[model samples]
Target: MTPTQRHRVLALTPYARLLSVWQTLGIHTDHRCVRGPDTGMAMVRGRMGGSGNAFNLGEMTVTRASVVLEDGSLGHGWVAGRNKPQAELIALIDACARQQAWARRIDSELVEPLAEALEEERQQASQAAAATRVDFFTMVRGE
Candidate 1:
Protein backbone atom coordinates (compact mmCIF):
# COMPACT_ATOMS: atom_id res chain seq x y z
CA MET A 1 0.00 0.00 0.00
CA THR A 2 1.03 3.60 -0.57
CA PRO A 3 2.50 5.50 2.34
CA THR A 4 -0.47 7.89 2.55
CA GLN A 5 -2.93 5.03 2.87
CA ARG A 6 -0.78 3.36 5.49
CA HIS A 7 -0.52 6.62 7.39
CA ARG A 8 -4.28 6.93 7.50
CA VAL A 9 -4.68 3.44 8.89
CA LEU A 10 -2.20 4.05 11.64
CA ALA A 11 -3.39 7.53 12.56
CA LEU A 12 -7.14 7.01 12.65
CA THR A 13 -7.40 3.56 14.17
CA PRO A 14 -8.17 3.17 17.86
CA TYR A 15 -6.13 0.80 20.00
CA ALA A 16 -9.03 -1.51 20.90
CA ARG A 17 -10.08 -1.86 17.27
CA LEU A 18 -6.59 -2.88 16.24
CA LEU A 19 -6.49 -5.55 18.89
CA SER A 20 -9.91 -6.82 17.84
CA VAL A 21 -8.85 -6.98 14.22
CA TRP A 22 -5.71 -8.88 15.10
CA GLN A 23 -7.80 -11.44 16.93
CA THR A 24 -10.27 -11.64 14.06
CA LEU A 25 -7.50 -12.40 11.58
CA GLY A 26 -6.53 -15.41 13.67
CA ILE A 27 -2.85 -14.77 13.01
CA HIS A 28 -0.78 -14.46 16.10
CA THR A 29 2.00 -11.86 16.21
CA ASP A 30 4.99 -12.53 18.34
CA HIS A 31 7.27 -9.56 17.99
CA ARG A 32 10.43 -8.31 19.60
CA CYS A 33 11.04 -4.61 19.86
CA VAL A 34 13.69 -3.64 17.37
CA ARG A 35 13.84 -0.02 18.54
CA GLY A 36 11.43 1.26 21.12
CA PRO A 37 7.98 2.14 22.32
CA ASP A 38 9.81 5.35 23.21
CA THR A 39 8.19 8.69 23.64
CA GLY A 40 9.96 11.92 22.69
CA MET A 41 9.46 15.38 21.29
CA ALA A 42 9.45 15.88 17.56
CA MET A 43 9.95 19.35 16.23
CA VAL A 44 6.97 20.70 14.38
CA ARG A 45 7.56 22.93 11.36
CA GLY A 46 5.04 25.15 9.71
CA ARG A 47 4.70 27.72 6.94
CA MET A 48 2.58 30.81 6.80
CA GLY A 49 -0.35 30.72 4.37
CA GLY A 50 1.13 27.51 3.06
CA SER A 51 3.80 29.42 1.18
CA GLY A 52 5.99 31.19 3.69
CA ASN A 53 9.36 30.13 5.00
CA ALA A 54 9.26 27.17 7.28
CA PHE A 55 9.51 27.91 10.99
CA ASN A 56 9.67 25.73 14.01
CA LEU A 57 6.21 25.68 15.50
CA GLY A 58 7.06 23.76 18.63
CA GLU A 59 7.77 20.29 19.90
CA MET A 60 5.02 17.73 19.88
CA THR A 61 5.03 14.56 21.90
CA VAL A 62 5.35 11.60 19.58
CA THR A 63 5.72 7.95 20.34
CA ARG A 64 7.45 5.57 17.99
CA ALA A 65 8.10 1.85 18.11
CA SER A 66 9.64 -0.76 15.89
CA VAL A 67 9.03 -4.48 15.85
CA VAL A 68 10.35 -7.47 13.99
CA LEU A 69 8.02 -10.31 13.33
CA GLU A 70 9.07 -13.92 13.68
CA ASP A 71 8.84 -14.38 9.93
CA GLY A 72 11.41 -11.62 9.24
CA SER A 73 9.01 -8.85 8.25
CA LEU A 74 9.84 -5.42 9.68
CA GLY A 75 7.32 -2.86 10.86
CA HIS A 76 7.48 0.49 12.57
CA GLY A 77 4.68 2.56 13.99
CA TRP A 78 4.58 6.18 15.02
CA VAL A 79 1.76 8.18 16.47
CA ALA A 80 1.30 11.76 17.66
CA GLY A 81 0.54 11.05 21.30
CA ARG A 82 2.10 9.43 24.36
CA ASN A 83 0.31 6.12 24.04
CA LYS A 84 2.97 3.48 23.83
CA PRO A 85 0.64 0.55 23.33
CA GLN A 86 -1.06 2.23 20.41
CA ALA A 87 2.27 2.95 18.77
CA GLU A 88 3.50 -0.57 19.32
CA LEU A 89 0.34 -2.12 17.94
CA ILE A 90 0.49 0.14 14.90
CA ALA A 91 4.09 -0.84 14.29
CA LEU A 92 3.20 -4.50 14.41
CA ILE A 93 0.34 -4.00 11.99
CA ASP A 94 2.62 -2.06 9.68
CA ALA A 95 5.20 -4.83 9.78
CA CYS A 96 2.52 -7.28 8.84
CA ALA A 97 1.43 -5.05 6.00
CA ARG A 98 4.96 -4.89 4.65
CA GLN A 99 5.15 -8.61 4.14
CA GLN A 100 3.63 -9.64 0.85
CA ALA A 101 1.90 -12.60 2.46
CA TRP A 102 -0.09 -10.49 4.86
CA ALA A 103 -0.55 -7.28 2.85
CA ARG A 104 -3.88 -8.10 1.24
CA ARG A 105 -5.43 -9.38 4.42
CA ILE A 106 -4.23 -6.35 6.36
CA ASP A 107 -5.66 -3.96 3.80
CA SER A 108 -8.93 -5.76 3.46
CA GLU A 109 -9.64 -6.56 7.08
CA LEU A 110 -7.92 -3.93 9.15
CA VAL A 111 -7.41 -0.82 7.09
CA GLU A 112 -10.72 -0.85 5.25
CA PRO A 113 -12.85 -1.22 8.32
CA LEU A 114 -10.97 1.45 10.23
CA ALA A 115 -11.27 3.87 7.33
CA GLU A 116 -14.99 3.20 7.09
CA ALA A 117 -15.49 3.75 10.78
CA LEU A 118 -13.57 7.00 10.73
CA GLU A 119 -15.67 8.19 7.80
CA GLU A 120 -18.88 7.24 9.52
CA GLU A 121 -17.87 9.05 12.67
CA ARG A 122 -17.09 12.15 10.69
CA GLN A 123 -20.43 11.96 8.89
CA GLN A 124 -22.31 11.67 12.13
CA ALA A 125 -20.55 14.73 13.52
CA SER A 126 -21.36 16.70 10.40
CA GLN A 127 -25.05 15.72 10.53
CA ALA A 128 -25.29 16.64 14.17
CA ALA A 129 -23.78 20.04 13.47
CA ALA A 130 -26.11 20.53 10.55
CA ALA A 131 -29.14 19.84 12.70
CA THR A 132 -28.21 22.74 14.94
CA ARG A 133 -27.55 25.10 12.05
CA VAL A 134 -29.69 28.21 11.77
CA ASP A 135 -30.31 30.38 8.73
CA PHE A 136 -31.54 33.93 9.04
CA PHE A 137 -33.05 36.08 6.33
CA THR A 138 -34.68 39.49 6.30
CA MET A 139 -38.47 39.47 6.05
CA VAL A 140 -40.54 42.29 4.58
CA ARG A 141 -42.98 43.96 7.04
CA GLY A 142 -46.43 44.96 5.81
CA GLU A 143 -47.82 48.13 7.34
Candidate 2:
Protein backbone atom coordinates (compact mmCIF):
# COMPACT_ATOMS: atom_id res chain seq x y z
CA MET A 1 0.00 0.00 0.00
CA THR A 2 0.96 3.63 -0.41
CA PRO A 3 2.49 5.51 2.52
CA THR A 4 -0.70 7.54 3.18
CA GLN A 5 -2.84 4.41 3.40
CA ARG A 6 -0.25 2.69 5.57
CA HIS A 7 -0.15 5.61 7.99
CA ARG A 8 -3.94 5.76 8.19
CA VAL A 9 -4.10 2.13 9.21
CA LEU A 10 -1.39 2.65 11.79
CA ALA A 11 -3.28 5.56 13.31
CA LEU A 12 -6.57 3.69 13.52
CA THR A 13 -5.32 0.41 14.95
CA PRO A 14 -5.75 0.18 18.70
CA TYR A 15 -2.66 0.12 20.89
CA ALA A 16 -3.45 -3.26 22.40
CA ARG A 17 -4.13 -4.85 19.05
CA LEU A 18 -1.05 -3.37 17.44
CA LEU A 19 1.13 -4.48 20.31
CA SER A 20 -0.25 -7.97 20.12
CA VAL A 21 0.49 -8.13 16.43
CA TRP A 22 3.98 -6.85 16.99
CA GLN A 23 4.67 -9.51 19.57
CA THR A 24 3.24 -12.18 17.33
CA LEU A 25 5.54 -11.10 14.53
CA GLY A 26 8.59 -11.39 16.81
CA ILE A 27 10.42 -8.48 15.25
CA HIS A 28 13.41 -6.84 16.91
CA THR A 29 14.94 -3.75 15.40
CA ASP A 30 17.09 -0.95 16.72
CA HIS A 31 15.49 2.45 16.58
CA ARG A 32 15.64 5.77 18.33
CA CYS A 33 12.91 8.27 18.99
CA VAL A 34 13.88 11.66 17.59
CA ARG A 35 10.65 13.37 18.59
CA GLY A 36 8.20 13.12 21.39
CA PRO A 37 5.36 10.93 22.29
CA ASP A 38 4.18 14.30 23.47
CA THR A 39 0.56 15.07 24.19
CA GLY A 40 -1.20 18.24 23.14
CA MET A 41 -4.49 19.52 21.80
CA ALA A 42 -5.31 20.04 18.17
CA MET A 43 -8.17 22.13 16.88
CA VAL A 44 -10.82 20.15 15.08
CA ARG A 45 -12.90 21.72 12.33
CA GLY A 46 -15.96 20.55 10.50
CA ARG A 47 -18.14 21.73 7.68
CA MET A 48 -21.91 21.85 8.01
CA GLY A 49 -23.65 19.31 5.78
CA GLY A 50 -20.21 18.35 4.46
CA SER A 51 -19.95 21.44 2.25
CA GLY A 52 -21.23 24.42 4.16
CA ASN A 53 -19.23 26.96 6.12
CA ALA A 54 -16.59 25.46 8.36
CA PHE A 55 -16.82 25.66 12.12
CA ASN A 56 -14.68 24.62 15.00
CA LEU A 57 -15.58 21.21 16.35
CA GLY A 58 -13.34 21.64 19.37
CA GLU A 59 -9.89 20.54 20.46
CA MET A 60 -8.82 16.93 20.67
CA THR A 61 -5.92 15.32 22.49
CA VAL A 62 -3.13 14.25 20.18
CA THR A 63 0.14 12.45 20.73
CA ARG A 64 2.90 12.43 18.15
CA ALA A 65 6.25 10.64 17.84
CA SER A 66 9.03 10.23 15.33
CA VAL A 67 11.68 7.56 14.97
CA VAL A 68 14.55 6.55 12.79
CA LEU A 69 15.47 2.95 12.17
CA GLU A 70 18.99 1.59 12.14
CA ASP A 71 18.79 1.41 8.40
CA GLY A 72 18.21 5.16 8.28
CA SER A 73 14.52 5.05 7.38
CA LEU A 74 12.47 7.63 9.20
CA GLY A 75 8.88 7.41 10.34
CA HIS A 76 6.44 9.63 12.11
CA GLY A 77 3.26 8.75 13.95
CA TRP A 78 0.41 10.98 14.95
CA VAL A 79 -2.44 9.48 16.90
CA ALA A 80 -5.39 10.85 18.77
CA GLY A 81 -5.13 10.44 22.53
CA ARG A 82 -2.53 10.45 25.29
CA ASN A 83 -1.01 7.02 24.83
CA LYS A 84 2.71 7.62 24.69
CA PRO A 85 3.86 4.05 24.25
CA GLN A 86 1.38 3.56 21.48
CA ALA A 87 2.72 6.59 19.70
CA GLU A 88 6.29 5.37 19.98
CA LEU A 89 5.45 1.90 18.76
CA ILE A 90 3.57 3.41 15.84
CA ALA A 91 6.63 5.41 14.92
CA LEU A 92 8.82 2.34 15.02
CA ILE A 93 6.39 0.39 12.91
CA ASP A 94 6.18 3.25 10.45
CA ALA A 95 9.95 3.23 10.10
CA CYS A 96 9.94 -0.50 9.50
CA ALA A 97 7.25 -0.01 6.88
CA ARG A 98 9.57 2.28 4.94
CA GLN A 99 12.49 -0.09 4.85
CA GLN A 100 12.97 -2.39 1.88
CA ALA A 101 13.89 -5.29 4.14
CA TRP A 102 10.81 -5.01 6.28
CA ALA A 103 8.15 -3.52 4.07
CA ARG A 104 6.56 -6.74 2.84
CA ARG A 105 6.41 -8.36 6.23
CA ILE A 106 5.08 -5.20 7.86
CA ASP A 107 2.39 -4.83 5.26
CA SER A 108 1.24 -8.42 5.32
CA GLU A 109 1.58 -9.13 9.01
CA LEU A 110 0.68 -5.84 10.64
CA VAL A 111 -1.19 -3.61 8.25
CA GLU A 112 -3.39 -6.14 6.50
CA PRO A 113 -4.96 -7.55 9.63
CA LEU A 114 -5.51 -4.10 11.10
CA ALA A 115 -7.08 -2.84 7.91
CA GLU A 116 -9.36 -5.87 7.74
CA ALA A 117 -10.45 -5.37 11.33
CA LEU A 118 -11.19 -1.72 10.63
CA GLU A 119 -13.23 -2.62 7.57
CA GLU A 120 -15.18 -5.17 9.59
CA GLU A 121 -15.99 -2.58 12.21
CA ARG A 122 -17.11 -0.16 9.54
CA GLN A 123 -19.37 -2.79 8.01
CA GLN A 124 -20.95 -3.57 11.36
CA ALA A 125 -21.63 0.09 12.00
CA SER A 126 -23.19 0.51 8.60
CA GLN A 127 -25.43 -2.49 9.18
CA ALA A 128 -26.54 -1.12 12.51
CA ALA A 129 -27.40 2.24 10.96
CA ALA A 130 -29.24 0.53 8.09
CA ALA A 131 -31.42 -1.36 10.51
CA THR A 132 -32.70 1.91 11.99
CA ARG A 133 -33.41 3.52 8.63
CA VAL A 134 -37.00 4.63 7.95
CA ASP A 135 -38.81 4.59 4.64
CA PHE A 136 -41.55 7.10 3.88
CA PHE A 137 -44.14 7.21 1.13
CA THR A 138 -46.86 9.79 0.42
CA MET A 139 -50.01 9.40 -1.66
CA VAL A 140 -51.23 12.16 -4.00
CA ARG A 141 -54.53 13.77 -3.01
CA GLY A 142 -57.43 13.51 -5.46
CA GLU A 143 -58.11 16.77 -7.33
Candidate 3:
Protein backbone atom coordinates (compact mmCIF):
# COMPACT_ATOMS: atom_id res chain seq x y z
CA MET A 1 0.00 0.00 0.00
CA THR A 2 0.96 3.61 -0.40
CA PRO A 3 2.03 5.60 2.65
CA THR A 4 -1.33 7.35 3.02
CA GLN A 5 -3.28 4.09 2.76
CA ARG A 6 -0.90 2.39 5.20
CA HIS A 7 -1.31 5.18 7.72
CA ARG A 8 -5.09 5.00 7.43
CA VAL A 9 -5.04 1.28 8.16
CA LEU A 10 -2.72 1.72 11.08
CA ALA A 11 -4.67 4.58 12.55
CA LEU A 12 -8.11 2.99 12.16
CA THR A 13 -7.18 -0.45 13.40
CA PRO A 14 -8.65 -0.98 16.87
CA TYR A 15 -6.37 -1.02 19.89
CA ALA A 16 -7.36 -4.59 20.68
CA ARG A 17 -6.73 -5.75 17.13
CA LEU A 18 -3.33 -4.06 17.07
CA LEU A 19 -2.40 -5.53 20.41
CA SER A 20 -3.39 -8.97 19.23
CA VAL A 21 -1.17 -8.65 16.15
CA TRP A 22 1.71 -7.33 18.22
CA GLN A 23 1.50 -10.18 20.67
CA THR A 24 1.10 -12.74 17.93
CA LEU A 25 4.19 -11.48 16.18
CA GLY A 26 6.15 -11.35 19.44
CA ILE A 27 7.93 -8.20 18.32
CA HIS A 28 10.88 -7.48 20.58
CA THR A 29 12.80 -5.06 18.43
CA ASP A 30 14.96 -2.35 19.86
CA HIS A 31 13.12 0.93 19.55
CA ARG A 32 12.44 4.16 21.38
CA CYS A 33 9.71 6.79 21.36
CA VAL A 34 10.98 9.93 19.66
CA ARG A 35 8.01 12.16 20.31
CA GLY A 36 4.95 11.26 22.37
CA PRO A 37 1.56 9.64 22.53
CA ASP A 38 0.38 13.15 23.32
CA THR A 39 -3.22 14.18 23.09
CA GLY A 40 -4.19 17.43 21.38
CA MET A 41 -6.91 19.07 19.34
CA ALA A 42 -7.08 18.95 15.56
CA MET A 43 -9.33 21.13 13.45
CA VAL A 44 -11.68 19.25 11.18
CA ARG A 45 -12.61 20.87 7.88
CA GLY A 46 -15.50 20.34 5.49
CA ARG A 47 -16.74 21.58 2.12
CA MET A 48 -20.16 23.08 1.33
CA GLY A 49 -21.02 20.26 -1.00
CA GLY A 50 -18.16 17.92 -1.97
CA SER A 51 -16.00 20.62 -3.52
CA GLY A 52 -17.21 23.97 -2.29
CA ASN A 53 -15.66 26.49 0.06
CA ALA A 54 -13.94 24.89 3.01
CA PHE A 55 -15.02 25.52 6.57
CA ASN A 56 -13.89 24.38 9.96
CA LEU A 57 -16.26 21.66 11.11
CA GLY A 58 -14.88 21.49 14.61
CA GLU A 59 -11.94 20.39 16.71
CA MET A 60 -11.41 16.78 17.61
CA THR A 61 -9.16 14.97 20.06
CA VAL A 62 -6.06 13.52 18.43
CA THR A 63 -3.11 11.58 19.73
CA ARG A 64 0.23 11.38 17.97
CA ALA A 65 3.48 9.54 18.56
CA SER A 66 6.72 8.67 16.83
CA VAL A 67 9.28 5.93 17.19
CA VAL A 68 12.85 5.35 16.03
CA LEU A 69 14.11 1.85 15.52
CA GLU A 70 17.66 0.74 16.13
CA ASP A 71 18.35 0.89 12.43
CA GLY A 72 17.28 4.52 12.38
CA SER A 73 13.95 3.94 10.71
CA LEU A 74 11.51 6.63 11.83
CA GLY A 75 7.84 5.98 12.22
CA HIS A 76 4.97 8.28 13.08
CA GLY A 77 1.39 7.69 14.16
CA TRP A 78 -1.61 9.93 14.45
CA VAL A 79 -5.02 8.77 15.49
CA ALA A 80 -8.31 10.30 16.55
CA GLY A 81 -9.20 10.20 20.24
CA ARG A 82 -7.00 9.74 23.33
CA ASN A 83 -5.72 6.24 23.14
CA LYS A 84 -2.06 6.57 24.04
CA PRO A 85 -1.20 2.90 23.67
CA GLN A 86 -2.86 2.72 20.30
CA ALA A 87 -0.85 5.64 19.04
CA GLU A 88 2.37 4.13 20.32
CA LEU A 89 1.56 0.77 18.76
CA ILE A 90 0.89 2.45 15.47
CA ALA A 91 4.26 4.16 15.60
CA LEU A 92 5.95 0.90 16.38
CA ILE A 93 4.23 -0.79 13.50
CA ASP A 94 5.16 2.09 11.24
CA ALA A 95 8.81 1.72 12.13
CA CYS A 96 8.64 -2.00 11.63
CA ALA A 97 7.02 -1.48 8.26
CA ARG A 98 10.08 0.41 7.16
CA GLN A 99 12.26 -2.58 7.69
CA GLN A 100 12.44 -4.92 4.72
CA ALA A 101 12.35 -8.05 6.85
CA TRP A 102 9.12 -7.11 8.59
CA ALA A 103 7.26 -5.40 5.75
CA ARG A 104 5.49 -8.41 4.23
CA ARG A 105 4.49 -9.90 7.57
CA ILE A 106 3.07 -6.56 8.70
CA ASP A 107 1.11 -6.21 5.49
CA SER A 108 -0.35 -9.69 5.57
CA GLU A 109 -0.89 -10.11 9.30
CA LEU A 110 -1.94 -6.58 10.21
CA VAL A 111 -2.82 -4.35 7.29
CA GLU A 112 -4.83 -6.77 5.16
CA PRO A 113 -7.13 -7.99 7.92
CA LEU A 114 -7.75 -4.48 9.21
CA ALA A 115 -8.49 -3.20 5.73
CA GLU A 116 -10.95 -6.04 5.14
CA ALA A 117 -12.69 -5.41 8.44
CA LEU A 118 -12.97 -1.70 7.70
CA GLU A 119 -14.37 -2.39 4.24
CA GLU A 120 -16.95 -4.76 5.76
CA GLU A 121 -17.98 -2.06 8.19
CA ARG A 122 -18.43 0.43 5.36
CA GLN A 123 -20.49 -2.06 3.37
CA GLN A 124 -22.77 -2.80 6.30
CA ALA A 125 -23.30 0.88 7.03
CA SER A 126 -24.05 1.55 3.36
CA GLN A 127 -26.58 -1.26 3.29
CA ALA A 128 -28.26 0.07 6.43
CA ALA A 129 -28.48 3.56 4.92
CA ALA A 130 -29.77 2.20 1.61
CA ALA A 131 -32.51 0.34 3.42
CA THR A 132 -33.82 3.64 4.76
CA ARG A 133 -33.47 5.57 1.49
CA VAL A 134 -36.60 7.05 -0.08
CA ASP A 135 -37.21 7.96 -3.71
CA PHE A 136 -39.44 10.80 -4.80
CA PHE A 137 -40.98 11.37 -8.22
CA THR A 138 -43.23 14.02 -9.78
CA MET A 139 -46.40 13.25 -11.69
CA VAL A 140 -47.55 15.59 -14.49
CA ARG A 141 -51.27 16.51 -14.79
CA GLY A 142 -52.60 17.23 -18.27
CA GLU A 143 -54.86 20.30 -18.63
Most lDDT-accurate candidate: 2
Model 1: per-residue lDDT, tens digit, 1-143? 66558867767777787788777987677998998999998999999878999999999999999999998777888888899988888888888788888889888887888888889999999999999999989999997
> How does each model score on TM-score?
0.86, 0.89, 0.87
Question: Is 2 or 3 the stronger prediction by TM-score?
Answer: 2
The pairs that clash in candidate 2 are: none
Model 1 alpha-carbon miss at residue 81, Å: 1.2
State candidate 2's TM-score.
0.89
lDDT: worst 10-residue window of model 3? 1-10
Model 3: how far residue 117 lies from native, Å: 1.0
Clashing residue pairs in candidate 1 are: none
The best-first sequence of candidates by lDDT reads 2, 3, 1
Give the whole-model CA lDDT for all candidates, comma-separated: 0.85, 0.90, 0.88
Distance from true position, residue 133, model 3, in Å? Answer: 2.5
Cα lDDT tens digits, model 3, 30-118, are 88899997999999999999799999999999999999998899998899999998988889888888788988888888788889998
Q: Which lDDT value does model 3 have at 10?
A: 80
